[model samples]
Target: MENMLQNINSLGLETSLTLDDIPNIDLYMDQVIQLFENNFNDSKRNQEDKILTKTMINNYAKGKLIFPIQNKKYSREHLILMSLIYQLKGALSINDIKVTLSDINQKIINDEIDLDSFYTSYLQLTGQNVIDLKKDMEERVKDVKKEISEAKEEDSGNLEQVLMISSLVHMSNLYRRVAEKLVDELVVDKEGKRQK
Candidate 1:
C-alpha cells in the first residue's frame, strides 16, 4: 500500500502567489493587470487565455466585487481582494463572491482587521488544503485498486484507469457541492435574494 502511494503521483495543487510576490507599493490599474498576467501565465489553459483585463477589473469595480481604488492605483489589499475574486469566480457566482468578500473588505477598509495577517492565514489554509487533497487522492486510488484486485494484470490496469477517473470526478463534485453549501449557509439572503 505504501509502495502504491509512493509510485502514484497526485495532481499538482499548490499553484498560487505568495504575499511576498505582490508589490508592497500601490500600483496603477495597468500595472496590476501586468502583475496578474505574469504571475498566472503558467496556469493559463491556452496562449490567448487572459489572466486579467481592464474591462474585467472595471466590471468588478462596477459590481462591487472589489473595494474602490485610490487615484487609479490599487493597494495591496485591493490586489488581495482581486486575487480572491479571480480564484473564486471559477467555482462561485460573481454575486456570491461579492457577498462573501464584502465583510472582509469592510474590515480591511475600516482598519478593523489586518488584511495582510488574514491573507497569510488564508495562504496557510490553502497550503494545508493542498496536502489534504493529495492525501485524499491517494486514498481514492487505493480504494479503486482494492475493488479490482481479483482481475488479471491487463484487465486490472484498464479497470483501474476507469475507476480512478470515476473516483476523481465524483470526489471533485462532492467537494464542489460542499463548498456551494458552505457559501449558501455563510451568506444570509437579504430580501430572500440568495446567490449561486
Candidate 2:
C-alpha cells in the first residue's frame, strides 16, 4: 500500500527529448522509426508496444501532421513535430492535433518563428508542469490517507489505492477536457479559420 502510494508521485517522470537529442541530418523512414523506439523506450505501456511505426508515420504524412517532407526523408523539424504529436496524442484527437499544428507549420515554413527556441521553451514548461503535477498528486495522496485514517470502509486496505487511482483519473480527465476546450477555442480549422 505504501509502495503504491509512493509510486504515484513518480507518475509524470517520463523524460523529454532535448533539442540535442534530435539529428540534424535527414532520416529515412526506418531511421525515424528506430530513433523514436530507442529514445522513448520507457514510454511504451506494454512489452509489445511500439512508439512509432512506418504505417503510422505514413498516415501522419498523408494527414499533413508532419508537413514539408523532402525526398522521402524527415528533417529535424519533422522529428520535433512528431515528438510533439506523440506527446499530445493521449489528450487530443488527430484532427485536433492537425488543427493545432496548422499554424505552427505555416509559421515554420514562413520562417516567422524560431522552432528551436519555441521547442526549448516548451520543454522547460513541460518539466515545470511535471514537477507541479507530482507535488499536487503527493498532496492529494497525503490528504486521502489522513481523511480515511479512521474510516471503517469495507476493503479498507485497498480503499486508499482505489481512491488514489480515482483521484488521478478524475484529475487527468478534467485536465484533458480543458486541453480539448482550449484547442477547440484557439486552434484554427483546416481552412485556417478559427471556430469560435
Q: What lDDT does each candidate get?
A: 0.79, 0.82
TM-score of each: 0.80, 0.89
Candidate 2 structure quality by residue, lDDT tens digits, 1-196 = 5665356444435566779989889999999999888888765667698989999899898998877789999988889899899898988899889878877888878879888999999999988887787677668878778767868675666898888788889888999999898788764344355333
Best by TM-score: 2
Query: In candidate 2, which residue pairs clash?
Result: none
**Backbone clash numbers for all candidates listed:** 0, 0
Candidate 1 residues 59-172, lDDT tens each? 999998888888999999889998888778877888788878887877887889888888888889988987786687678877877888855456687778787878778877
Clashes of 2: 0
Number of the top lDDT candidate: 2
lDDT of 1 at 164: 80
Candidate 1, residue 57: the lDDT equals 93
Q: List where candidate 2 sits over 4 angstroms from the true fold.
A: 4-12, 187-196
